[model samples]
Target: MMNDKSLDIETAEGNAQPPHLNFESSFPSENTQVQTNTSEQRSAYQWYVVIICMVAYILSFVDRQILSLMIEPIKQDLMLSDTQFSLLQGLAFSLFYAFMGVPIAALADKKSRIKIISAGIAFWSLATAACGLSKNFIQMFLARLGVGAGEAALSPAFYSIVADLFPKDKLGRALGVYAIGAFIGSGLAFLIGGYVIGLLKDVNFVVLPVIGEIKTWQLTFMIVGLPGVLLALLMILTVREPERKGLKVGEDGQIVKASFKNSVAFIKTHKKTFFCHFIGFSFYTMMLYSLLGWAPAFYMRNHGLDASQTGYILGIIILVANTAGALFCGWLIDFFSKRGYSDAAIRTGMIGCAALIIPSVLFTQVENMQLSFALIFVAMFFSTFPIPASAAATQMLTPNQLRAQVSAKFLLTSNLIALGIGTTAVALITDKYFENTVMVGNSISIVNAIAGVLGVFLLYKGCQYYRDSMKTENLSKS
Candidate 1:
């Protein structure tokens, strides 16, 4: 339940004059009376918002993952090495994506979130299509950088919208639903990309006079990129911006704006939750980046499957396990919070997941292909199960006004540390152990396991912070 004082402040928007900047509120107060329908009506609208955001998110992942499917074809055509491929996959995309998220998030906070999201969809979609036109490694790398830049705007805006649409109690479920887009988009990219590329193999199309005939992979990119344009149009037409919360003038007559300095101050004041979330997100990205970026290649080389077959099998695992894990984590977090164990849910989930990952990684190194596939599915399930908890914890720690910026900051920190470092680290390790494929596989398992353990410890600390915060709030009320 919302605090009575908070609700009063929310309702008194027109009655109370805006507070001045000199006000000493530790957190920004809810000032805007967002035009919302009744609870039942708003509940229905929230679902609609979630659906649209999910589609946008789906498109984002589809654009991001398509490159991995084309890595082999691109490498063969461009005459590139694994190291070069790794740069295209990780560093090139992550560096710009990480840096761009902040400014994009700031824009989302200040502008219409729907517009930012729609523009991002179109931008990344075009960038993906551009990938098919690249003549060399450098061109492909630059195209990927564009794709990353576009994607950097998505999650922060989407998260802020979700927070606005749903109440605190229901936010976990909403966010979990949003997270499913990651799985669905990634799974579909592999499944559809493989089939599309297979059909287009050795085919020629006269799409452009200057470019003349285009091959299968190029056509695949163009086909995939075109759909996002339509999705972007839908977002612009359908989604409405919610009223900004926590931007109200308090009794002191000051209007609150969430600035970068304010965001940093909030984190500094909540250091434990801040650092724990950062570390947890880093480890999460390490596993996800390594898996998504390289799993298809792993299947092609180790399991002796063609791209299409590998994509289908992996898609099945992702569709099933990732969806289930996301839903399960949301349900568990809410349930545990009701039972007075808010942070325990996340801590327990991560620790158990870490334990499961060790064996899953070991099994992935097994020579038997069937056993390896089964283990990979198990690994993916456990690996993603804590995502809801981690996301929820981040949202819970920050005030409403700074939600987008904080979420973007979280992504920025995590991406730099995890996606940037994790994928590059795995590639370097694989290259170093190239003389022994067994050692390469083993090294990935070891690095991921160690990271998972560290994540567990961080989550425990997050739990402590959460508990202390709750106690402090309770005391203040008393």
Candidate 2:
């Protein structure tokens, strides 16, 4: 491996040749020891890239998740069942979002990531706004599917972009900061959604000049979705695509395409590690999506807090607590990884499972409302803790050629199961078994416990495989 002090110097100097420069002179590098210049990778333009990507990530979550806060309004508006609403929130979105990731990621692996991201941002933003125009459940469902398809193009590109932009030493922190979009966007979705709801609550209807005749929830979707269009334009204009380092590059300064077979072969070579880690993350995602998707409903049903009130409290907790936890976990992983404890990332994943299991399961059962809020806040923090470390670990394991596709496969499988299951399992319990909306709290507890147990088991089993994978990379880089 590159000496710690030398890499640190390289990082601080930020004056090395771009890694692609080396790859351009060579082809099919077997060693994958990319000597990226810290100067180029850590430049002002580089940081600009991460910051804008973070903003775009934040907006994506806002557009996608605003529906969670508007669940009741949408339910009443469309005259739907909890199961049907859950379909809109869960399976309908996940099916397209998860499945579409593979092809889009394959595209990202060969094409310009910025084009995919910018165009996707514009597409999803418009799709999110289209939800505002839906007068029926089918129309809303189809619009959400469009939103999912657009979002499918992002994360593969996002992770791949960040991996190329930052070196190994700084990747954890950078990705963690980027991952904050997940929590922060969700928080802002609630915050902005709530604030919008409050504004329109007293008024019967809102009428804009060009787009006349909209309701409260519809107005909220338009408010949250439209800004992203402008953000997408800014992204394409400003965010330069990072050169694909440690791989073959074309004359256009892009990575030469790797076949889908090559990506699958890579995964096949490390089946145990990839499978266990992917499963662990999927289980973790299950617990997370449930809390974010249904917690507002829980607050409304059990604690007598309305949408605005639930949004304010939960939004504060998610924005503050989850952000702190993600950054701290990122720092911890980087610190330990630098010290040669290469198992740091997955080990952190284990710790996150422990932290979330009890708190998340107990939060809904707590008798006191204040204590319940505190517990849920704690739960949210730990739920976010695994993301950065786990993602950094995965990125570290692969070369640029395989990174985006591997990430897409992980996203595809994980979201299909977790998003499909996590977001809907609670509602299934409430709608089918309990037959009461107030029973959503019980559903949350049950689902969290199950997924937590699964996460702990899978992550534990993967520890040795993770260590072995790290050692493999060390040898190659060295």
Candidate 2 local lDDT, 247-353, one digit each (tens): 73555997656768878977887899889889897898789899989999999988898898888888899999888878877887787677766676787888888
Error of 1 at 209 (Å): 4.3
- The residue-by-residue lDDT of candidate 1 on 196-291, one tens digit each, is 867766565436677766667777787788799898899899779997654534347775576887778767877776787777757865776677
Off by over 4 Å in 1: 1-39, 202-210, 246-255, 348-352, 436-440, 470-478
Candidate 1 local Cα displacement, residue 137, angstroms? 1.3
Best by TM-score: 2
Q: List the residue pairs that clash in candidate 1.
A: 18-253, 18-254, 19-249, 19-252, 19-253, 19-254, 20-252, 20-253, 20-254, 31-248
Cα displacement (Å) at residue 82, model 2: 1.0
lDDT of each: 0.75, 0.85
